[model samples]
Target: MNPEAWVALALSLKVAAWATAINLLLGTAMGFALARWRFPGRELLDALLTLPMVLPPTVLGYYLLVLLGKRGWLGGWLHEQLGITLIFSWQGAVVAASVVAFPLVLKSARAAFENVDPQLERAARVLGLSEAAVFMRVSLPMAWRGILAGVLLAFARALGEFGATLMVAGSIPGQTQTLSIAVYEAVQAGQDASANTLVLITSLSCIAVLLSARWLAPQRSAA
Candidate 1:
């Protein structure tokens, strides 16, 4: 592979890592809440969160552009107040990957949390463990493997994020250009060799991640 391809790979890894970290924190909390807390619109919230998984990438990109564009409401405030710009930047790529990959972690984490025995949590509470303590000591530990599987999947998804990242971050070589974007660029420019290299690398990376996730995921007993 060429140096440019290597750089794109590194950048994609960086974006995926950042996205996975964000998803780990946010997805875990939301998953635990949805699994344990009953409230009005709970299902509604889950549906909304899961929408990205099924939505067209271009559509999601449009939404992100609208919400984070220079003249957008939140974007305008952020740019004015914090002097932060997300458009056509690598950070924007991170945000795009995070949004696109979040649902995998959320769904996996929710299922993991749900699989934990509520009775164990009750016992922990009965033992005078605070809610926080119970979660930290019992719930989180029990669900970690499943959550990890989801995290791996999210990382893989983020690594390959294309349309949204391109829309929000554009394809700036060695800046905002990720592996997937590089592939697109290579193909567009008729650089078949570079495109093949990128495609191979991406496929291998995703395959490795999926295998790792499968290995780490909890196995079910025969019914």
Candidate 2:
């Protein structure tokens, strides 16, 4: 309703967009790999990738802080080499959201790839198409709708990411406070009107995204 609320909502959209883009790129690759490959430890790797979906957001945030805090091993290296600091920053929120949203995309993309007919793949290979060509022209086309459904699913998850985003990004108003955080603070401060506005926006955004996902992959809707 106010300028501050507008800023948080805008920031949330920006962060969620970036996070969803990153998830789509990496999740599609990993999901396709897992679906198409057979190797030792594959099951273990899949479980590890999917762990975020089941973990509490606070727990995930704590791990991110441990891994990316200024004095942390990876964080220290990043700061020293690249001058990149994720802690208490919007970039950190993107990372947090991406982590939690990853499994959704991966689950859908993997299922899409798995559902592709093996006969079609063999046919493409026999037609002299390279592996990449077959995937791009055949496999990807066939599975694209499902992959898109997965992408929207991830985007929706990223949009409302709160606990992990708050821990790493610190809810710094215009800088890092997302819609979820805005609603949270509004409630805590007894600004019921503001909280209700934020909640309504969030509810609509989620519904729009989920409906888009369903429309994208009607045949494989996650009923």
TM-scores for all candidates: the values are 0.95, 0.95
Q: State the lDDT at 170 in candidate 1.
A: 100
Model 1 per-residue lDDT tens digits across residues 35-114: 99999999999999999999999999999999999899988999999999999999999999999999999998999999
Clash number for every model? 0, 0
- Where model 2 places Cα greater than 4 Å from the true spot, the runs are 214-223
Name the lDDT value of residue 180 in candidate 2: 98
- Candidate 2 has a TM-score of 0.95
lDDT of 2 at 83: 98
Q: Model 2: per-residue lDDT, tens digit, 1-223?
A: 7898789878989999999999999999999999999999998999999999999999999999999998999998999999999999999999999999999999999999999998999999999999999999999988887789889989999999999999989978889999999999999999999999999999998998888766656665454
